[model samples]
Target chain A: MTLPAHGLPAGTLRRVRIVGTGLLGASIGMALTRQGIDVELSDSSPTAQALARDLGAGRLAEDGDDAAAPELVVVAVPPDVTARVIADQLHAYPTATVTDIASVKGRILDQVRALVEPRTLDRYIGSHPMAGRERSGAIAARADLFAGRPWVICTDEDTPAKDLQHVVDLARLVGGTPVHLDADRHDAAVARISHAPQVMSSLMAARLKDAPMDAVALAGQGLRDVTRIAASDPALWAQILDANAVEVRNVLTELREDLDTVIGALDGRVDALGVLASAIGAGNEGQARIPGKHGTAPTVYSTVTVLVGDKPGELGRLFTEMGEAGINLEDLQLEHANGQQFGLAEVSVLPAARGPLIEELRARGWTVPE
Target chain B: MTLPAHGLPAGTLRRVRIVGTGLLGASIGMALTRQGIDVELSDSSPTAQALARDLGAGRLAEDGDDAAAPELVVVAVPPDVTARVIADQLHAYPTATVTDIASVKGRILDQVRALVEPRTLDRYIGSHPMAGRERSGAIAARADLFAGRPWVICTDEDTPAKDLQHVVDLARLVGGTPVHLDADRHDAAVARISHAPQVMSSLMAARLKDAPMDAVALAGQGLRDVTRIAASDPALWAQILDANAVEVRNVLTELREDLDTVIGALDGRVDALGVLASAIGAGNEGQARIPGKHGTAPTVYSTVTVLVGDKPGELGRLFTEMGEAGINLEDLQLEHANGQQFGLAEVSVLPAARGPLIEELRARGWTVPE
Candidate 1:
């Protein structure tokens, strides 16, 4: 087998076993196998394991093969069955460093703690690689799925350093940046940033179900952004929201309090406008705190909107012009109006570059309106 | 002045007057002036009006100049003072067709009805152009701001056809697609499609205000989208929410009901998973119904993600290659991972083009994992 051009150095992980051949499992297997690590794949469904093996994720595992013992075991399964499968893996591979990639960590840790002995638990590390695609299953596996994503590794005071290092090395080998956090903190963080946002997006989109067609026709970019994730798989979200119910509920409860305040103000409170203003102002403050690209502090970029025909090669020409002008695009959004034959390409650049870029585009006969 | 390349056909509107030179008013002025229409500008702030005039939006209006009588008058004032200004302009220009571009139509219509005679009100048509910019005032105005956007015209049964036609002509002249709806219906539609989404976005973002930095650090694209519009102007949004309080509150109250149900299910209610699943399922259905770009039925596009280095002209090179391949991009989203040196450019195209495009991109030495 050919080694990946950027494969992990020698003396790293020699062999790994992934216990489920689903999307995450197959993807992890593919990444490790590409790095020249010996990866064995297994699944509850023989067809799935065979599919993953055929896709070059890894070789099919043979039961009772002590000669092929893995240096590490990765448990990738459904959340409801994750702890059980992790416990079984720990029992089956007593010498291997064990880890599970579960989105919600605290509850899984508690469940695993109850199912396994303390000594076995010392070898287990809980991690969550924050990467996924809308599609699932082995057919959707990718070797770079975890590339450039955060992989949260959960540990406590009792966790062994050697075992933790093995998991961290695996994360890096798969092209993920390892972040350390305790199980409880990781759960809280995911709930606040991911879980709560999903619930809110779904809730907002649900209101449009019975809305009049003309009303929905009036929908714009704001509505589109707020509800985009609502198209996520309901069964999976139900599992995730159920697992992190408490933290998700806490956030929703506080959001409801803010909603009530706005509702009450709109219902004609004494200082109605003040309450309304503060609600939106607080949002401004919070939104400004979200880190910008490359995890840097939020930087405000100046946007220049240029009109382009709705056809192929138009955007390429516009972006090529910007490139010729040596202005790097900080962000871009293409807005199409209802029944319009053209779109507005809102190109954001550094504040200092805005004037020159606009002048250059206008000189090149592109429409950059004042 | 030289005639615009695509000036409106002769004998449409000879002279028009605009009150309040904020973003909307100034943009309207600029568009008309570019179309070779005689636009007269006036604002409560002389500085704003002068800025708009100097920027070629229009010539400044002189008070009580009979020689400069306009064929139309557009009152583009703040929502709170919109009706008063509309009524005053209608009385001041007895022969001109007067219209106001207020986001909330019903309240302004009610107030104008209470203040003016039926004959006077017949000449006052309320129109709302669903277009805006993040920055306000004359400096941010663009001649093409309303191009290819929806311009809602609110008219009652008693309204004269002559005045309605004038507003429709103006909408077309400025490149807007005019949509006909009564005052109350227009208000309700905006409340559902625009105002309510803003309130929900702000409420979601407000929850992040006091969150731990670590928790906020875990923010992803989903969180960014749900709270993107939360960075909107508070004072402006407050006025909008207060103007359409009833409809906005109605939508929010129903959303709160769904939130309560989800909260109840998460509280360990019997069949909790069913409740949660249906909640997300309803969102999927509703989100599916939102019209795609160009106001057509939602069309699902297949996305191909390619790794792009974070630098100037990297995107230009990528798009230039796609252009060479002759594939039209239906949509594009750039995702940057925290602390990563590269970003993923998710290029969406027709399902028929996905395989060929991926092969083409991969052959060009771009990293496209499968």
Candidate 2:
């Protein structure tokens, strides 16, 4: 996981202290450590700090180890405790600038300001890296977790330019793209994209819990895709939703109206076809709003479905052959049939490459279904 | 696509008539035709019928053709037209055993029963092949589309064993496993797993349609997975949802209640964490109800994440090496850092194989991050 050094000095910061040793904190520590920056880690749970240390995130911090404070401190605690932790970190290292990576920013910023003195508030900022896996803890931490991810920094009137620069530099050091935003806007955006989706996905999957086994067995890739996020960390998500509940509720209310309209059409009170088509069309437009190079979906790309054994390395080989063919993949989706031997790899490529890619793969002893 | 066939007796019975030339109809025609059975295609749109015919789905039905009757008539039309088409097919081919592949079974069965004579009703059966793509029309048809998917048969009291066997034989010919259930059960099952999911996905995506670009850009894999099904055929889904509105509404109402609970927790009115945790836990349980090779999930399978380029053949190489390692992949997921040069292949294998697989992959010059 080592890479050539960058962000050699965290801008006048001789050392960095991370107050939490969870995935986000440990990952920040590792990323900074990789750049030869000195990092100290501590967690309320001794085992956790020890584990993060064992994972090479950083060394443990001790009282009076260095009366001269580190240049910066990062508080990566749970959302509910973020403000308190941020205030503590600001107080613990009086000279050090501090930032907390909390998904919900508005409340945390307000709470931290109320808890800390005006002087300490100037040295603190709130930021959130739009990154995480479904798993939790230091065990899930990686140096490259935040690479290429968006890290939103919330600015306050009391925040100093020096502290903001340090935070931005840290984000860059971790290979994150930093975006400047206010706390309210950041919270609102995340509520729309993150918290609401979690609730929706969970609500859908919840229906399946009480369903018959046969009905559940009737599930397909569509159901799998729609319910995948329903598997997120319950403890963490609960905290996040509570933090951003108001904005999330606004989104949820609108969704309810759409649901009610579709239900009415389905109930045969209106022209079902028109109502249903408009609902699905709205979804289509919404999905398209997700900007990417995915190209024109459900079209524009020719799908080359290669059947590989569900055993290990088959996908690797298939993709390797695709590389040899010199075809760019617009997207790749893998679908498995429970009782079937083959896993279906639906690779979407440019329509122009369809003939050549399929021909090349088939010639390379792969099964390319037309 | 040719098969040395056992459904040859189906060919001997006269012909197989597909009354719609869309994906399902064309696919059924192709599967039957490939099994060396005679197939006749007809659709309301001449262009659609012609396209299906050109795609080798089947030959077009002539004016004087099937005077005696085809052995089987599949009414693969929209849910609204299903009953009428089934009745028309039954009357047109009095001696033929008729089936409709509409998603909903109860209403269609009731409608057809009320429209047709007792004997004609006896000759018809309601069936739904639990398969579809996000796309529609003849262009998306495939002979193996139904392979490894469940085909549900809605049985009636008057359904003769011989007619049922004919339908079962058709299912087998298309590589489907047939499950027999009454119309009510079939409707309820599809409502829970299929129709309700569509409504939920669409409802979520509908929110995104008016979202700010930056907010949408904050979208991640979870959002994508949850909204992927929202891109389905709205016209078709509207009809399907309308046909099964009652059951869909029941599920939606319960979901609304769960939403309210979570909203309350978010509003700081209740023990937010407890309510949120329970809601998420319910989702976890419901997702678990999905019968699959995925056991406990996020735990059962040891994940060996292999870093590979987002290019054509990198994935193929990873899978090939996986096969060479002699490890069976329990499940595989591919995640790419948006705008990154490479994607990560997360291969889940048996816990025992994890250590060896990682060592082997690393030895072969692939990065297997823990």
Candidate 3:
């Protein structure tokens, strides 16, 4: 029996089969199931499939052996196995549209193309939802993980519009905004934005490997923010970086040049200050190029830092007051003093809301510090 | 007239003078004046001093021209000018304990030691309150700037106990936890943790100077976090880097070796994966070494990522519910999806509260995603 559409047209995607029950796969299944669509789960590891099933991501494929063929098959295996799984699934589910959610797209697409016939290729598209956490495994999966995140849909020149549409629908069904990008452009984009930062963060944190505890103790928000993502699973990261090595290498080579110049300046070059200043100035421009916190467009929000008492509910009361004032807190951070009894909640709101939020908080007898 | 100690003894610090009216200077003056202590402000820039005075940081030194010698004198100037200012203030306020708030301690302390006689040296202590913002100037200053932040106080062998105590009192008066570190150790610690990250962030962002716009549009939270501090003022950073050059250079050199190894692996050595994996894994260990969010001690907080609706008071309501459940929200980040209606509020709380918090949230009909 066909079910109502999760997001795509009715009957077009009544059932989805996920070939791997890892973080991304189970997450996709959970999201689709939450939308009232049927999802089937399988994994090379039976234990993992049981875990994903227990997590309510989907039913085990074994439990649905006699069920009709899935309308869609998602190959969510690791990059090395992704092509093999896609080929196997494409043959196994002739009527299903196939897609894979791998971080690196171009190489995987190339591999799948070599393994499949042109007709089989027509039913396949590659998509990547740009969402992840430091943790991994089925236990860490979430239904709304892809919500409001960007999902890149890579299409071949000969890809049918309808097939592309199906992949885009899957992305949207999970609450992602699908952006059309060619495989090459997608790889290059991730290499610049994702891979390079991972390398730099890893390298930067590597210096702290044997650092004195006291030295590490002085870590502030700046250092913390820059190195937060350095805690990602290393083996997984190595594979992702390996797949996107060429593009990452290109960026790293250029970054090394800048590093060398900084070293030269530090070695007491006559024009060291000028070199150092320009390096830092370019950084200012680069950082400004990033989209604002909300990710829609560029914005410069003003922060209204308020005194937050250590007592329970003080923060809650402050947020409640802000909410009642019709102010939306775009972001907030709590900075408690090293050994102090109170802390500051630096609340970032829309620039226009800054004055009103602060004025209202103070009017309500709260200490709205700068 | 003696005033009740603003967390310090009364007559011991009846009046304070700040010799610079920049962000840190103005913030200190404002916090002191708010506690009912007499504060005097001065700056080479008359406009700055006037603005700081108008902002209630303190009265202009003119108002205190005939006042008794300040019981305490603070020198808050640029790194290059720190030694000169400290020497000038020490001679100007012989009865007052003289201290300078500079980021790099060893170099400035050496300069001061060379400039001052033995008695003058006994009155001088170098301090650094590990609190700063990307912005500068008196306008950006806040009275609570140092609250809950670590303040490093460096003392000389000949420094009298009372003089050291007064400097410690200054740190506490502004709501900071005073930690004593020799100038050498303090400089080395900041060089490894702070200066090196600044250089790395700037160098990484520098590579984006000529990058395609489309690539930059793919920037995510990871890239933004790694480069957030790159927006700092270049000229000021260059000066700071110059003062801590030797130690910073040492760390950079070690980091460069790691970079070379990473590049070698990316070039496809047979042992590439192991090398790359080790680098990334070392990062995992290093990142864990950092103290928790507030810098007080190491803490392992579990994050509960809740699906927050876009409605104005949704966050407030959620926080209020959390407060009612007796969960102290330690830290938080709100990530809004691009063009999406809902956001994720990743709330950090005590690990013990994770299960209860999630159970309560789900029972209250909120979606607490993994």
RMSD for each of the candidates: 2.9, 3.6, 2.5
Best by TM-score: 1
- Expressed as tens digits, the lDDT of each residue in B97-117 for candidate 3 is 988888999999889889999
- Model 2 lDDT tens row, B242-307: 788788888888888887787777777889789988999899888766766432122366787777
Q: What are the clashing pairs of model 1? A: none
- Cα lDDT tens digits, model 1, B1-370, are 5353355555347688999999999999998887788899999998999999998889998766997588799999899999999889989999889999988988988999999998888899999998886678888898888887889998878878778878888898888889998988888889988898898888888888998887787777888888999999999889999999999999999998999999999888757789999999999988998888876467788999898887777887888888899988888888886777778889899999999999999999999877
Tell me the DockQ of each model, to 2 decimals.
0.71, 0.61, 0.67
Candidate 2 lDDT over A147-253, as tens digits, reads 76778998867678788888888888887778888888888888878889999999899988878777777777888888888878888888888788789878888
DockQ of 2: 0.61
DockQ score for model 1? 0.71
Evaluated at residue B264, the lDDT of candidate 3 is 80
Question: Using Cα atoms with residue i matched to residue i, what is each candidate's TM-score against the true structure?
Answer: 0.96, 0.94, 0.95
Against the native chain B, what TM-score does each candidate's chain B reach? 0.96, 0.93, 0.94
iRMSD per prediction, in order:
1.3, 2.4, 1.6
lDDT of each: 0.87, 0.81, 0.85
CA deviation > 4 Å runs, candidate 1: A1-11, B1-7
Per-residue accuracy of model 3 over A252-327 as CA lDDT, tens digit each: 8888878888888889975877888888999988888877656646688889889987766788788889889999
